[model samples]
Target: MAPTATRSPWPRVGAIVLLLTALLSVIMIAFAWPATRSSVHDIPIAVAGPSAATAQVAQQLSAKRPGTFDVTVVDGTAAAERLILDREVYGAIDVSSGHPQLIIASAASPAVAQALQQVAQALGGTDAGVPVRDLVPLPADDPRGAGLAAGALPLVLGGIAAAGVLTSLVVGVARRLAGALAFAVTGALALVAILQFWLGSVEGSYWLNSGAVALGIAATALTILGLESLLGAAGLGLGAASMMLLGNPLSGLSSAPEMLPSGWGTLGQFLPPGAAGSLLRSTAFFDGHAAAPHVWVLLGWAALGLVLAGLAAARTARRPAAAEPAAEAVPATVAV
Candidate 1:
């Protein structure tokens, strides 16, 4: 008589899945965190104190950190306002008089906006004079500051695909490369079409749109594939956080780095998604101001990814002699 083997409850298995999901979630979020516990240096801010005051503020910012605040000295208050409207600087200060004015575009990074408000308050010291208030707010529907989101889309999509690929890699599983790549490319193109046609993301030739979208898709997929080959599952989380979160935030999504928080603000141009987005936008709206650099960046990512994938595959290649096991020599008489 054999006793029936006891079976474990399915609830424990569910708990383990849930636990893993939660752990991954935690790790991913941590990787994407952009904030320091207390403060960030080099935020692009507008200082409009008097010529002396403005210059002083600009100098103070530059002195604090390189690539933090660009500190443009506008012609006058109206010019500054226009800059804000055009999504130029985050906000402008008007230290034209005894008091100084603090301005901010709420549509930009809320953190930077809050930081500007704090700066305004600090300037309200007893020594500071009367202050005027002017608001160059973001569009009502632009809370996420998506006006600047176009440029970062490539990075975000790239990361998402990378993460998906990486998750599979973590399990020591590989999906159909062609199928996944095709899907990835299709999704990117669809997004580009939607943004360009529906959202009026660009005002250029259809060829340009197609080219830009295709370039983005190719670069993103290649980068993810390359990263997965190099870093395995971990690269997925890292690339996602790097391209999507940090790259977008640092790329002047809402306002240019000139108005970004000190330090990381100046870093906007060099970041991948940041650079790619700007280049695409320039080609879309403007006439493509020196797009070669950005094109190279995207190409570089794609190329690197491809190479890594090849290397990964090569590493798993069957050895030439290993496949042919040695055969025993048969006697000549046995041939008959």
Candidate 2:
């Protein structure tokens, strides 16, 4: 009887299945828990008024929800508005008048604005007379932020799709790079056209929006491609997990990061999707004031991806050529 094969594929298959199951479990927990358990924690807000009254109000608000706010006392309403515009604070409360005034930049986050309104109302003792003002309101066309929030998932999906297509169909480093660039430009144009021009959700310089979207796509594509080049198929799995499982839900595109559960907001901001979302928001609404750091983050990821691709290409180039079969005719001479 022929010797039995020593190695079995079953164990490897089982291990892969087990690993994937564990990964899925982790992904569900990370995403679901934060979303379900979300609450205010250390959200920055300004309380603007006479120093004594502002301090008292701040103290009261903090007491009501300890660790919910990082309250700063601003001298006046103008100062608070400036902070909001600078993306320094989400909302401001002015207790100078007989009725408390809650000032919010709804463009920054409608959820945050709503929360501030609730807090202000609570502070007013159920008389229900607090005036909530939206200093930087969202576009009237997309008043509920539905359009912008809806854009995030598509952007992520588009990046993943583009990368997957390129890796499957394209060959050679130069060709892949070129394909990525072309896709980035065209995809950005189409997405911006739909979201900004047709839907009117995003309001900004057309060129600026186009550039931001393009950079985001390029960063994502390059990173995925780089991982594939360096680590083969496993790299693709890791990339998908990072971009989809970890990045998307934590992104806080539908709401401000500060509005999410503690620590998750900051963690999300460090990832590409979060950075892209923040950058897009700045370009569309805030006149690109706070977009520099996010831009840098995207660029950094792109650079890292390019570097990995280059290294992989170099390694592939240096691989030894396979040996050809030996000439068959020479074997009979010795027996003769």
Candidate 3:
């Protein structure tokens, strides 16, 4: 019998790459999305005074504003002031005096402080004597009143950068789909912990944070995987470009979504970064108020990716139409 021929190994490797790429891309996108940050509400503020007084005030504030601020109780006004200096509280209340004083410290989200001021003034006399000042002040280089521009932003962006680079490596040639997914999930969880618990960007429910992290990674990866499924490796570049350049700044990562151009603010939620960012905000700061919208958006993206990837595989199995070169003229007349 004639010797059996060994098959070329390239197509097998390509198939493996595509599978691994899909799973890995899903994970990477999840980590790239920033955690929740509301330009409007749920700012952390410390409260200090007699337990009775502070409790009443906190209850009153929540009752009036509902979801605007989360009041964290401190030992005393001194402690509240200290928390402000430590960047722990967006604003503070000292109910020690006959007319309680309000302290607004965080410059990053002055609207939060301003909102608190209105509430405090409505309850008490005036924040005119409440001593509103910037304690752990914003850097001169920053224009955003919030100091987050310098500190938390770098930390957040650093996490995204690392995730992207590592994802590129793992997804480029890996053949294990589960491993790729694990890599992305782990990266996003680590980043979520850093920002939410360790770094103090937010304080919220653990399940909410976990969900947010999962969505963040899923959104980024889905977009990337969709492109790769359509255009192979080149799609990775396009996805990265869309996420880092077009998505971040426009998504309002450094500020409130509404603060950007009107159209951008409205449409940012449609982008992966925007969807993830909104999802993060819902868990971290919004007290799950707007969670439904973002959940559906990210979930839709994830589902779309799965569907498209499946279709691409099926399409790839079909043979493309064969093209034949023009017939030779038999050297025109030489045959005769």
Per TM-score, what order, best first? Answer: 2, 1, 3
**Weakest ten-residue segment in model 1 by summed lDDT:** 30-39
Instruction: Tell me the deviation in Å of residue 235 in model 3.
Output: 1.5
| Candidate with best TM-score | 2
Q: Which ten residues in a row have the lowest lDDT in candidate 3?
A: 321-330
lDDT of each: 0.59, 0.84, 0.60
Candidate 2 wrong stretches, greater than 4 Å: 1-24, 321-336
lDDT of 3 by residue, 168-191 (tens): 555432232233356447766776
lDDT of 1 by residue, 1-336 (tens): 999999879999899999999978865653343333224455545665467778876765566454545577864677776666555566777776655777775644555666666666655665553354535343344344464465465545654665475456544324534534565556656666666566654455656655655565566556665667667767656666566656666666444454544556556556666556656555554445446776787777767767877777667564544555633344345665
Top-scoring candidate (lDDT): 2
Candidate 2 lDDT (Cα, whole model)? 0.84
